[model samples]
Target: MKIEACAILAALLFHSLSVSAQQGETAAAAGFSKDIAPILTKKCVACHGPEKSKGRFRLDTFEFLMKGGESKSASVVPGQPAQSELFRRLTARDEDDRMPQKDDPLPAAQISLIEQWINAGAKFDGPDPKAPLVTLIPRAPHPEPPSSYHHPVPILALAFNPDGTELAAGGYHEITIWNPNEGTLLRRIKNVAQRTHSLDYSPDGALLAAAGGSPGQWGEVAVFNPTNGARVRVLGSMPDTALTVSFSPDGSRLAVGGADNSLRVYDVPAGKEQLVIQQHADWVMSIAWSGDGTRLASASRDRTARVYDAKTGDLETSYTGHQGPVFAVAFSGDGQRVYSAGRDKKIHVWDAKEGKEAGQIGGFDDDIFKLLVSGNWILSCSADKKIRQHSADKRELLRTLAGHNDWVYSLAVDGKSKRLASGSYDGEVRVWNLEDGQSLAAFIAAPGYPAAGETVRASTRE
Candidate 1:
């Protein structure tokens, strides 16, 4: 009886091992060009590519793969999938030392594909001109990210739909679309190649205008079809770095501001420069055209915010109240009131038509980098890392959102839903459900950010 039992056990073990090997065969049948190339493109190429050969490794070709890097050994041994150094790095947890060194770890399915490919002896017919490594084209370069919090991309600008159903976040190299309620990233707009600075959606939500590029180097102000991120119009280019952009309320015109200290207007579809409102004495850091598009308000390091006539290219008002450089400007819904903030550590509201001080709200201890006014409240974020919500009518401090450990530089408002979005200098963007004064979501730009002394230490309700 004992002999019979041993024979049965040995047969069962042999069958199981055969099944495992066959599973690997199925994956190998999918092949290197089809199954493995994608993993290399998304996860391996960044560190081991032509532009940056970190560790002296290049995974672009099978020859490069077999030659390995400075470690002086093949990263993958044919038929020994379990002993591959490439696989080890892929599974490593130390972000600074890990392969790819950008976002989250590769998916299990992707890692499995490599294991099966190696177990099949890592055989390849090499690159084929006719085949060209066809892959399932992802909808966009970044596609739908699994999580914004852990992504390597840092958010530079964000805007919301009028109905407040969607939030659009522009990143260093991509844009993250999210569900405001769930704070989940839905899609990424990846058409622009460089780190983006400022962006705004059209009134109807059909178009998006984005600006800012290589620091000190101005980039293209592109009008994109937000649904698919197809460039509808290369509206214009800034000869000098532009910091902010705004779409006219009617969507017929675009206003861009930057270091050239000019606010240039371009006719949207025609992509022609309509008029250059180059009157500011310092970098025009902010631009906002009133509801009728007749007046353009600009804030700058010139220690003042000016309102210009869109048609005549004339400065209509030099509204100055703050003692320091003004950094942000916004017009109220009706265009009757303007809010400007700056290093003065106070927000100055002005009568748009009269160009006189309407009210002054002060309390922030640092430069006020950005501001957004919604309903009856003015939400301001400053270098001190405090988000202050003030009574728009009374200009009184209602609440200070204190939690971030760094300076806040950008603000987005969902008018209908009362949601406030803030992007910070420390490389993080967060959404607040203003109804209850609670944070809805925060997307950290890059990992290892907020190094000592540079982070915002504001405290707010979660």
Candidate 2:
């Protein structure tokens, strides 16, 4: 009787131990949504995503990932990492047989996690198997900007408030507003992306919109209150950085273009996506709205400039004469023509309706970076370290502002104050007198980096 009782207790202890071990393995398994999805989406989805699928293989979703593209063999076999083709390809030694062909191999830690997941039964932990990997990933907050600068950051975007009292320049992970005339840093708005690529203020001056993001990871459009430097809302998010943003003439809509090759428009007050245009094959480098707000035009790296019907999001016309990647675009005041500039190094004017080249302005020393239409003048900045103003109607060069020491990447104009601001690759911001092109005040937009004669205060909190 004593022996039988002891045997029964031993059996129960063994069963309890087995159950605990199983639970531990289940908890230790790698999660599809949290761990595996980010790796595949960043490394593999560019080729095997909705836009293009090579070898009929796609890893955008859990269901499709296990479906095994074109191959009769299983892509991922539960409980067996050695038998899984996906795991084998990831661990393959030969360059030709390895996954993510041209790119660098996945880090060993990531590979080990994937192998552990497959060995633990490759289970689906998310709510849905067909959901896209992009949706499964949560939005992570951007890192805080440096309290003090060790080096000056390049300024890629600049803007003036509607009343022209302040100038805003893009800094690393923040936007710094400066007193335009005195060259004093007025305020710094934080929580921006790694880079702010474009900036624009609403027609009424109530809101300021900045478009930018981490280069290949995330994109965002943030709207802020110009008076207090408070972030009012975020307009859009994408898979890559948002390159440029433009507010409609009436301040009712905002159009954003990005490296993802899509044009997105959002209703200002509602903060809802109104239209998404994906006609461009490469980055939509620049975007502009017509005077009447009925049409939109975009310049792209695919060597094309396109006009679209704003209301219906339909292609109106495509201008293909640039023959190189076009970087900047602007609509004529009358909305009858579009002026675009690019690596071709000439500003081309084309009829918006006919898509035929109307005229061209030459003599630019290098690639043009940005174009702005203020009053009767068309302002352009280029890699040649010059800013040129031209007659909007005649397409003739009127004035040239030449003092920048590096490629001028951005331009902003305010007719009320007769002021123009330009940012360059050398981290300099030059504010000029719009009437005579005289340098009004120039300073490095970088906070904490004092210029030759002036000291700048570094403030990242406000």
Candidate maximizing TM-score: 2
Residue pairs in clash, model 2 = none
For model 2, residues 1-462, the per-residue Cα lDDT tens digits are: 999999999999999999988766754767877888889878887877656777898887889899988877798999898999899888899999899899899999899888878877898888778866765665575688888777777789999998889999998888999998988889898878889999999999898899999887668898988778788988877767899999998999999999889999999999888998999999999999999999999999999999999999999999999979999999988899899999999999999999999999998989999998888899999988899999887877889998877788999998888789998887888889979889998888877887724533332322
What is the TM-score of each predicted model, taking all chains together? 0.63, 0.85
Could you say which candidate leads in lDDT?
2
lDDT (tens digit, per residue) of candidate 1 on 148-199: 3342344557788667788777765566667766655566676663666788
> Candidate 2 versus the native: TM-score?
0.85
Cα distance off (Å), candidate 2, residue 346 = 1.0
lDDT of 2: 0.87
Candidate models: Cα lDDT each: 0.73, 0.87
| Sliding window of 10 residues with minimal summed lDDT for model 2 | 452-461
